[model samples]
Target chain A: AQSVTQLDSQVPVFEEAPVELRCNYSSSVSVYLFWYVQYPNQGLQLLLKYLSGSTLVKGINGFEAEFNKSQTSFHLRKPSVHISDTAEYFCAVSVSGTYKYIFGTGTRLKVLA
Target chain B: GAGVSQSPRYKVAKRGQDVALRCDPISGHVSLFWYQQALGQGPEFLTYFQNEAQLDKSGLPSDRFFAERPEGSVSTLKIQRTQQEDSAVYLCASSFLAGAGELFFGEGSRLTVL
Candidate 1:
């Protein structure tokens, strides 16, 4: 079975500060990684995905993530974040041949002004 | 609407009652999915449909939960004799690709069992 782990339950950061949300996964077969953001009272939106090719995947809103195969981790990062960037971020994993997405517990990012 | 739309944004029902939530995916979409999102938790896969056929329903929790996409466009998730644990947000998503691609999600139908 495939599972995703997001250790941090909540993260608090000051505006314009660097931030990183950790994500780790365990799977027996090849897997795809994704990051989705959910604003308050809204549906989840795709931030970025890593299917294949380069590991350094960049997404909208100046966010990027590095996929480390050895560590089995795909942590999302941003050089500087804004107050508007505060939202609940989810890390999901999908098997190579299926559309099933196993999501983590989620990390709530709070940007303080 | 251009995006996925779900009916009854909020639903409240007593325990042991039956409830059905509807989802309308984007036009011409081939893949439709249902996910359950508990409060303070991430969304979990419930079932998946490719066109009019249900390809993967292994994620469904139990037989009490049923979903169908008859025409490959609109889907309905029905809960029989809903329990307190069934209180969660039901989200519907669709993708043009068959199996693997970005998913466009709906606002979700929040079910509250009292």
Candidate 2:
């Protein structure tokens, strides 16, 4: 079984400021990592993913995440945030060989104007 | 349409009543999944289907929860004798394949048991 841990339950940042949301995972086998954003009353949208290759994965909306295998971390970052960036973010992991996904508790990002 | 769709966006059920939620995956998608999201928490896997076969259902909380993908495109999740604990958002997602691919999600069906 695989599990994900998001250290922060909520984060507040001023507009145009940089922010980071931390995530870590535990799995016995290799895994794929992903970040998803969900707006109010809406479905989740993919932010980025780390399947293989480069450790730094760029996503939409000026967001990026770094996959650190040794540390078992995939932290999401944005150099500058806007008020519209406020949303709930989730970090998930799927086993390398399976379709089942395990998601973190989630981090609520509030980008204040 | 373009994205996954779920029916009965909001449902209110009395305790001990049964309820069913529907999901329509993207055309040609070979894999589908069901998850439960409690307030302030991330989605938790419930079951998965590959084509018409149910590949995994280990995450289902109890035998009272049942899911089926009859024709491989539309899936249904049925809960029998619903309890207050069953009140949550039921999310449906689909992917082209199983691994290393992105999954598209639906708005979800919110079920409230009172």
Candidate achieving the largest TM-score: 2
For candidate 1, report its TM-score: 0.97
Candidates in order have lDDT scores of 0.93, 0.95
**All models, DockQ values?**
0.70, 0.84
Q: Write the per-residue lDDT of candidate 2 for residues A1-113, one digit (tens) a residue.
A: 68899999999999999999999999879999999999999889999999999999999999999999999999999999999999999999999867878899999999998
Would you estimate the TM-scores of all the predictions?
0.97, 0.98
- Which candidate gets the maximum lDDT versus the true structure? 2
TM-score of 2: 0.98
Indicate the worst ten consecutive residues by lDDT in candidate 1 chain B: B95-104
Q: Name model 1 segments beyond 4 Å from true.
A: none
lDDT of 2 by residue, B25-77 (tens): 99999999999999999998899999989989998999999999999999999
Which structure among the candidates has the greatest DockQ?
2
> What tens digits encode model 1's per-residue C-alpha lDDT throughout A1-113?
99999999999999999999999999888988999999987888999999889999999999999999899999999999999999999998988768788899899999999
lDDT tens digits by residue: candidate 1, B61-96: 999999999998999999999999999999999998
CA RMSD of all predictions: 1.0, 0.8
Q: For candidate 2, what is the DockQ-based docking class? A: high
